[model samples]
Target: MEIVNSAKEIQEYLQNTRRELHENPEISNKESKTSEIILRELEKFGNFNIRKNVNGNGIIAELIGAKEGKTIALRADMDALQIEEETGVSFESKNKGVMHACGHDNHMTMVLGAAYLLSKRKDELSGKVRFIFQPAEELSPNGGAKGMIKEGALDGVDAIFSMHVWPDLPLGKVGIKEGPLMAASDHFTVTIKGKPSHAAKPNEGIDALVTGAQYVTAVQTIVSRN
Candidate 1:
């Protein structure tokens, strides 16, 4: 009950921070401004031993508890997608051609919210809490997590927890399971070439657009059909 009440007290803080982040979204590998804001907020929290610019705009913040125990980590992604905002919200993305479409703004705010509450309740804790703010999550095969780990983000961590916002879930509800909650992602690139045709010509040249669309439709069903 105490923790719940404390979290409620910071509800406004969480919302405002989330909105601030959403308004100025940055794409993968370009989260400098995002890292600055996170650093500022963590500094205001005042108990974390923060390491900035870890593996390109990543942040690792550690908070020691009152007693000696294990270390735990909480992670949040810090990259936005290359998308334009059409949500029409008052605090929609201000950076053109980039948007927090993946809810990373929310994820960062949630981690900061946890940091805020934990900062105030350090006396009750027995272990250390590490907060990891990683960038370039949208870039696969070479995401920021690899660099963060190389920078010792998990040097002394016993366990780590991270979560994402799911639009499929009901409002104010959280879903969790024992095993993995998200599926692995794979990236691929395909290029199709076609001869150029005059605008007035009906069928003189091959239609690469149609070929690409057909390929996309066929590829989309690979997993389901297999």
Candidate 2:
């Protein structure tokens, strides 16, 4: 595949989008404002069929070419983390206790940049391009990707491509892997039920704090031994 070499232009666009997203960070499924911004930008391209309210703030845009060919999908997640922003940038997040530290802002911009480039060359492409703006990617238990799939996001898709911004990679370099590029992430919470008693009386009640500590240690050993 040939690389797009408009680094200066793409960087400028990416910086603007990143700053705007950072200043107005939204969390998880509640990304209405972010979705609106994305929809507005995609609309400006003038040849896409937009679908909104897709699996809770998810957006899909389809760009069909003239010739008959396969359909490819590009995905970008648009949710921010729950951490407080410490970056002293001028466009820092206006929302309290939320930030885009994980580079979803860049993800959206990169895909949009690709879309902009592809839009100019629509006549040359033989197939369709679907841009998926997904939400709740940072949410646990259920993410927007699963929700969109449930809503038929992949019904007619032939191949899908997604990318994440890696800070460890060099500025001009790109990394690609064939299979299983990352590990599966899982979060667990263990709650202990115990009787509460006065602190002055020792051994009167089951200490949940101690039990929780023991359980954490046991979980660590389980993973280590496995």
Candidate 3:
């Protein structure tokens, strides 16, 4: 009850933080500035045992309860995609060719908001809470989570939780489920070799572009047709 009201009180703070992060987006494994801003903001809380530069540019802020209980972890990614921003928003990305296209800026801000609210009620909590600001989440197959875990980010932690923004939901609404809400992502690379020849030559060279397009069409039907 009181915590909910506290959250409302910090609405403007969270918005400002989100906008600041959005304007200076950084790509995966290259979030030094992003981490610095988050670290500075976390410092204002004054009650967290903060760990900096965890597994590169990640930050772990842990808050312990006054009593004995389980430990829960909250995670947020700190990476942006290599996409140009055209939102024309007041706080559009200043980093050309890079943007928070996947809403990681919001994710980070949401976790920070949770940290603020929970820190205020630390005495009432029964267990420990770890707010993990992870980097390189956009780099699938070799994400920053692996490095952070290797560096013991999850050590002594009982469970972890995270969320992503869905535009389908209306404002002030959140969607949840009983099981896994998102699917796994994997990547692969395909190389096509073709010979190049003069434009006037008749069928002397193979066309890699056409071959690649045909391969893409064939791959698309693996789920729909098969």
Question: Which pairs of residues collide in model 2?
Answer: none
Candidate 2 residue-wise lDDT, 1-226, digit = tens: 3445754556787788778877888999989889988888888877888889999899998888878899999999999999999879899899999898888888988788878878877888888999999999988767788989998888799999999889899997889977799556777777799888888985798998889999888877986798
Candidate 3 regions exceeding 4 Å error are 191-210
Best by TM-score: 3
Candidate with more favorable, higher TM-score: 1 or 3: 3
The C-alpha lDDT values of all candidates are: 0.94, 0.86, 0.93
lDDT of 1 by residue, 166-206 (tens): 99999989999988778778777899998789889948988
Name the weakest run of 10 consecutive residues (lDDT summed) in model 2: 1-10
TM-score of every model versus the real structure: 0.87, 0.88, 0.90
Candidate 3 lowest-lDDT run of ten: 179-188
lDDT at 116, model 1: 95
lDDT of 1: 0.94
TM-score preference between candidates 2 and 3, better one: 3
lDDT of 1 at 109: 97
lDDT of 3 by residue, 87-204 (tens): 9999999999999999999999999999988888888999899999999998888899999999889999999999999898999897889977876789899999988978899499
